[model samples]
Target: MYIDASLFMGMHAAVPGTRQACASFFAEHLRDRVWMTYEEVGRCDDVVWALPRDTQDAYYPFMDVLHSTMPVKRVPYTEDAWKTAADLPGRGVLSLRERLLMATVIASDSRLVTVNPRLLNLADQGLPVAAPENSDGRHGAFPEPLAGLYRTSLALEIDHARI
Candidate 1:
């Protein structure tokens, strides 16, 4: 499943109220497969920088855990993913970062797991796309990761004809 940055940074936004929903969301959806986009990494880092730097730098410890211990996968953005994101009909409606994350989700063949209403709109319009088997090109295993970007070379129909 694709994860939104909010699920990460919001859990420790240096604000208790912000974390309540994020914590609840995670506790309720424990078993879903999860991945984070490069955009999300930057967003999380943004949160880290915003925190008051104490003697121990509390956020780094959490970032270290995210970078290592979490079962979450790190998916990089590639040309194909960019193209997919750029071509989205709803591109006008989404924030630049959200578009990238959604593109990564589609390219990686995972359902977006977000509490973001904008992305949920795509789900409502039928996202969580998988490759088509009939050779419109998305018919096989993904290509090897190019540079930092992961396997999304296989052409995919991003679930909704409208999106």
Candidate 2:
């Protein structure tokens, strides 16, 4: 399971009761299965570059947790990934970060566990997308119905902790 920045933020923010809850969730549910890309981790670090030096200290611990807990795999931007992203029909709508993430997933041949569903609809362009069934609050697993594949914010928050 490859996680993006949004999910990484959730883990970093786990505090007080949330910290214990997140720890139990990760140990029981995701420890061995979850992994993140170097690109994703770097994006988190990039946040520091945008913040003032005085504020960077406050965010460093969260960033440190992300760096230490999530196994980072360094994946380079490849021709095939760019080609796949270029082929996406609504490419114009995606931000640079989203494009890179889509491209990385394409290059890795790994499923993206994101809340964004519109990206999946662009699979016709060659990026294979699938949301986990457990991601849906009621389903506990992805259903064949397809309509409920993407998650709502509350479910995403829970799933983020699990990841």
Global Cα RMSD, each model? 14.2, 10.2
lDDT (Cα, tens digit) per residue for candidate 1, span 107-156: 77767655455666776667873211122422222122221121121111
Candidate lDDT values, in order:
0.53, 0.49
Worst 10 residues of 1 by lDDT: 147-156
| Top of the candidates by TM-score | 1
Q: Write the per-residue lDDT of candidate 2 for residues 54-75, one digit (tens) a residue.
A: 4565555444443455345556
Off by over 4 Å in 2: 10-30, 33-38, 52-55, 116-163
True lDDT of residue 97, candidate 1:
79
Q: Tell me the number of clashing residue pairs for each predicted model.
A: 0, 3
Instruction: Provide the lowest-lDDT 10-residue window in model 2.
Output: 146-155
